[model samples]
Target chain A: MAFNILIVDDSKTIRSVIKKTLEIAEIPVGELYEAENGQAGLAVLQENWIDIVFADINMPVMTGIEMIEKMNADNLLEKTPVIIVSTEGSQTRVEELIKKGVRAFIRKPISPETLRNVVNEVMGDYDEGGN
Target chain B: MKEETKDIVYKVCCDVFEHLAFMFGEVLDEDDITSVADTFIKASMSFKGEQQSGIVAIVVPEELSVNLAYEILGLEKSEQIDPDGPEDAVKEVLNTICGRLLPAIFGDSPIFDLTPPETTVISYQEWEELVQGHAYISLEIENNPVLITTSL
Candidate 1:
């Protein structure tokens, strides 16, 4: 099944890049939703059949960490897969994200390969490598 | 700028532009940097982390900001600029730079919280206030002037 993914970042350029990168990685995306920040991202979650989320840690209105924390609190979307796609480099921050139930964290300047591998890791046997 | 800070800034600026923006840049001597281009857009953000707390800013020429929006978005070059697109791109590139820069300098054990980058129109005077008194590192992105400053 093709996955429906959501990207949350304040930068339109970054959202566009992530969409482009997903196509380049050959990850079959059923639909792609873009949100400017965590608040908007949470709203997208409510309105779509999103399978995964790729979020930037720093964003206006709401940060990625806050979004994930909210998700964790909501029983409905709590188990949804979340991968942090951010420029955040601090080890301590990474630990905090992991503690909040983030499935993976990928740094900025992310390549097609990194996106593909992380997606595969999250999806388990549903590997894009086979596709 | 301290030699250590300059080195970190230079490396981060180079990496962020080349990889994220698909643009190549090299840090130049402050004397070598010039503000001949008048119209500009500036993006500034603050970072709080284990060892450092400072402001990071990136200023780019007016036209270049629009050009970069397309470049980073993987869109074909166009004559018209999407008003919000250019400013968003400029701000994001700086945010990405700080995000990448922090990990490189502080190691992963420490954490940093970065403010969302803000982009604005500015006169050369405001730009000078930030760039002055430091051996600021400047670059030519696609031959257009770009300045990056970090105050700790």
Candidate 2:
């Protein structure tokens, strides 16, 4: 089953790079969506059926943490996986995010291999067409 | 800044450029600093940690900025690029560099709050003024001068 993914970042270049990386990694994507910040990401989430979300930490209007908080407040959205794709590298911050329902954290300059591995690890058995 | 700190910033700058844009950079000798181009782009961002707070900035020639954008986007030489591509690319580069540099300097335990990166286009004369006032780490990437500075 192809997964519907949402990418949230302030930089258009980064959003494009992540999309390119997902394509290069050959990850099966059902419907890929883009948002410039966390507020917009939440709007997309509310409007679409997203399997997973890739978000950056620092953004204008709202932050990734804030978006996650909003997601956690909802019953259905809380179950959806969120993997952080950011330049942030603090272990403390990582732990904090994990505690806040973040599935995984990926640093910037992400490689195709890393993305593939993270996807497989987070969405296990999905590769075999399992939801 | 101390020489050791400068060394760390320099190393981080080189590594980020190579990893993010597939561009290799070498440490530029101080004496070799010369006006190679009249136009330049400067990207800067601030960070606040528990014990340290400061700003990190990067300056690159306009020509190099375009190259950075193209390489980062994995575009061909003939492909057209958006006008905002170069500016966005440089800002992202600085953002990545700042993120990595903080961890390298202060370890992974200290969480940092980083401001969104800001960019500006400056003339060579303005660049010269900045060079004279700040202690910056210079690098040569694609034979163009790149500068990184930190203000604590």
Candidate 3:
């Protein structure tokens, strides 16, 4: 089964690159939704059934952590895995996110293989038949 | 900062260009980037943390940014890239570099909040004057001149 994914980041360029990376990684994708900031991301979440969320930590209107906090509060959306795709590299911050229920963290300048592996681990394989 | 620390900054700049832009670059010895080029775009970002607070900036040549956008977007030659693609590319690249550089220099414990990148189009004359007294390193990417700077 293919996965419907949402990417939240302020930079259009970064968002585009991520969509391309998933394609390059050959992950089966059902639908791809994008939002510029965390507030917009929450709206997307409410409207669509997203399997996974890839978000950046720093944004103007709302930060990724804030969005995650809201999601954790919502019982309906709490189970959806959130993978932080950010420039944040501090161990302390990363630990905080993990403690708050983030599934994984992938730093900036992310690679295709790394993205694929993390997604597969969190959402299960898209192809289903193969690893 | 020591001379070696500056070298690490240059190395990190090279890594970002190579990894994100899929291009290679070498550091240049120059005080002013404007003296070397006429038209370019600049992107800057700031980071605030307990250990340090500073800014990082990158100036890229117009044509190189176009090539980088095309590479990053993975579009065919026939598909035209966006008009502001170059500026946005520089900004994103700056964002990536700043995120990586902080951890590389200060270890993994410092938690910093980064600001989204802000980009501008400026002439060499403006760039040369704007970067005065800043600690910076210039690089050559695909025979095009680019400059990276840091201020603490």
- lDDT, each prediction: 0.83, 0.91, 0.84
Better of 2 and 3 by DockQ: 2
Listed models, DockQ each: 0.76, 0.88, 0.81
Ranking by DockQ: 2, 3, 1
Question: Candidate 2 lDDT, tens digit per residue, A8-63?
Answer: 99999988999999999999999999999989999999999999899999998999
lDDT of 3 at B31: 46
Top of the candidates by TM-score: 2
Best by lDDT: 2
Each candidate's B-chain TM-score, in sequence, is: 0.87, 0.96, 0.88
TM-score of 2: 0.96
lDDT digits (tens) for residues B42-61 of candidate 2:
99999998899999999999
| Runs off by more than 4 Å, candidate 1 | A125-131, B79-81, B125-135
Expressed as tens digits, the lDDT of each residue in B1-152 for candidate 1 is: 67897788888888788887788887666676666666789898998865779888888987788878887777887445466889988887888888877777767777777888887898877767656856356887887768887785
Counting only residues 3 or more apart in sequence or on different chains, how many pairs clash (N, Cα, C under 3 Å) in candidate 1?
A: 1
Alpha carbon deviation, residue A129, candidate 2 (Å) = 14
Span of ten consecutive residues with least summed lDDT in model 1 chain B: B127-136
lDDT of 1 at B46: 94
Stretches > 4 Å off in candidate 3: A125-131, B31-37, B130-134
1 or 3: which has the higher DockQ? Answer: 3
Reference-based TM-score of each model: 0.90, 0.96, 0.92
